[model samples]
Target: MSKTNQVKEDTKSVFQNKGSRRNFLKYSGAGIATAGILLMGCEDNENMVPDLDGVVNLGSGDVGVLNYAYVLEQLEAAFYINVVTNLYRNISDVERTMMEDLRNHEVAHRDFLKAALGSNAIGELTFDFSSVNFNNRESVLATAKVFEDLGVAAYNGAGKLLQNPDFLLIAGKIVSVEARHAAAIRSILDSDPKSFAGNDVIDANGLDRAFEPAMVLNAASTFILNKINASQLPTS
Candidate 1:
């Protein structure tokens, strides 16, 4: 099967598997296969990301950055999937549609990066969203805000680390989308809507917040069950 079609099928299976829902969120979460589970058979593959004592290392250069982005996309996609599937209490039609759209966008981002990375793509990641109370609308929205804002910051920070122009361009485009997602979620949660240029994420220089890979991973590792090693990623 073509790479795109293969990704579609893989994602379809994930979405259709109701039994796996328990793996994602504390309440109705859908779990994706962990790298530890998927990497057992690829021990000899030279192109695969190195697995040292179950730690999935994000290889150096643009590939590492792409894989890092892929991880965030996976987390965002899974969160939105569970949110749409279970629909928090007393959700409005507008909110439901917004969640669905966000899910689609995140899934697309996940698939695109997977396809672009091809054989170099890292294995699917497992997440522990036990902290998010999916049954409550307030809890769900607040968590969404965190993910969107973090995703935007992650992309912004990683963009500078990419050595290839094409990869940098792709990162720029994805970050813009993430910024929009952040704005949308913020608008839903806040009484006053400031859009993508919100003050919380923007500094006095009027630029969105940027987080280095280590910092981003440190913040994100709480929700991620897998051990990710970004030690090899470029710094300058």
Candidate 2:
């Protein structure tokens, strides 16, 4: 066979063998196998502002990861604050109380990161949530669910990327709280209160989903005024 043909076949086999490879690891030792989960070839879809115009570069190393989390928290905090400060038309007292709690929780998370990172923390980000219809309950709840779920996945994915065990431990704690927020938002979204752990985020094996930095940021960038470059974040 020609060299080009052999190369094409090799590449195809590699992808095709991924499932078998994953199965082998699973059979070897489930716990150890899961620790090796790393996404390959994830594209950078963040609509980055031209560097010529000056963009926010989330510095390299552990600091970049923290800045990424901080920026996400900033977005969440701003969103919940917006919802709480301006109650929608005919929004119930129950919703008002819940939103107030969410707002406070997000604010606490954002502030904690800021304090932890000190001067390394990313600056406050401005958001463009014009697509959200605050007056409509359905619209508000749906958006909340989206953000919370994304937050959980973002934390989970970034957890493995942290070199510092302290940072990883703290990220795990934050993700747990984010998962709770996701569940609460999901419950409110569906008329049935028991729909918190929907299939969208939780799989058949009851595992939470994870997205690489680029994937998460791309999904989230639509809401923020500033774009984040997470390329410098550690992958291993």
Candidate 3:
């Protein structure tokens, strides 16, 4: 009857609904390949790959940022799903429940962005987390902190690139949720509720840090395998 239980039930329902072969193909692009191919032909391909330095590629304006966010969410969603599936060492029931919730949240965000972007969204990325020790608590939490912080910074950075107010509004809502996720992850790791509330993200004026899409994309390229085109984004 609790909110968490409700969320769990909803997630289960979603999985069940999509678990069928027909539904899976329907949502997973088997039915949309022709449409996707047509869209790709007209889409801008210049920004698909990162810049010459291989750090930043702003693709093209608002869509590019959305794709960037999509990529990060894909990473987070994949990581959390792996965690839930593997059940790493010393993980408690509470941790497992909370992580499942996080997994569902990430999946929702990922799907939302993919849907909103339509054909503009980047292709599915190949992630390399070999550096992360999934069985170790320290490794997992540390990686989570990095991801959450980066996600918050990414949304903050891309605000200016968004020409549509609706997109900006959606980004605001999602980033706030990401901040909460960051706070919770920090609390779990260090027992400090405010560990993630420092000047790095929050400034001396009590404002969150904002970077341009170029900068955030540059930072993110290290973790993601697929290159991003951030050149279409504003530099200043």
Q: How far is candidate 3 from the true structure (C-alpha RMSD, Å)?
A: 8.6
Residue-level lDDT of model 2, residues 6-95, one tens digit each, is 533432332233564344222222222222121111212242222434467776666678778888889999999889877788987888
Q: How far in Å is the alpha carbon of 191 misplaced in model 1?
A: 1.2
lDDT of 3 at 56: 41
Candidate 3: Cα lDDT at 170: 68
Quality of model 2 by C-alpha lDDT: 0.72
List of clashing residue pairs for candidate 1: 21-29, 25-29
Candidate 3: where is the Cα deviation over 4 Å? 1-58
Return whichever of 1 and 3 wins on lDDT: 1
Say which candidate scores most in TM-score: 1
Per TM-score, what order, best first? 1, 2, 3
Show the lowest summed lDDT stretch of 10 residues, model 1: 21-30
Clashes by residue pair, model 3: 57-229, 57-230, 58-229, 58-230, 58-231, 59-229, 59-230
* Per-candidate local distance difference test: 0.76, 0.72, 0.69
Task: Between candidates 2 and 3, name the one with more favorable lDDT.
Answer: 2
- Ten contiguous residues with the weakest lDDT in model 3: 30-39
Count clashes in each candidate, considering only residues at least 3 apart in sequence or on different chains.
2, 0, 7
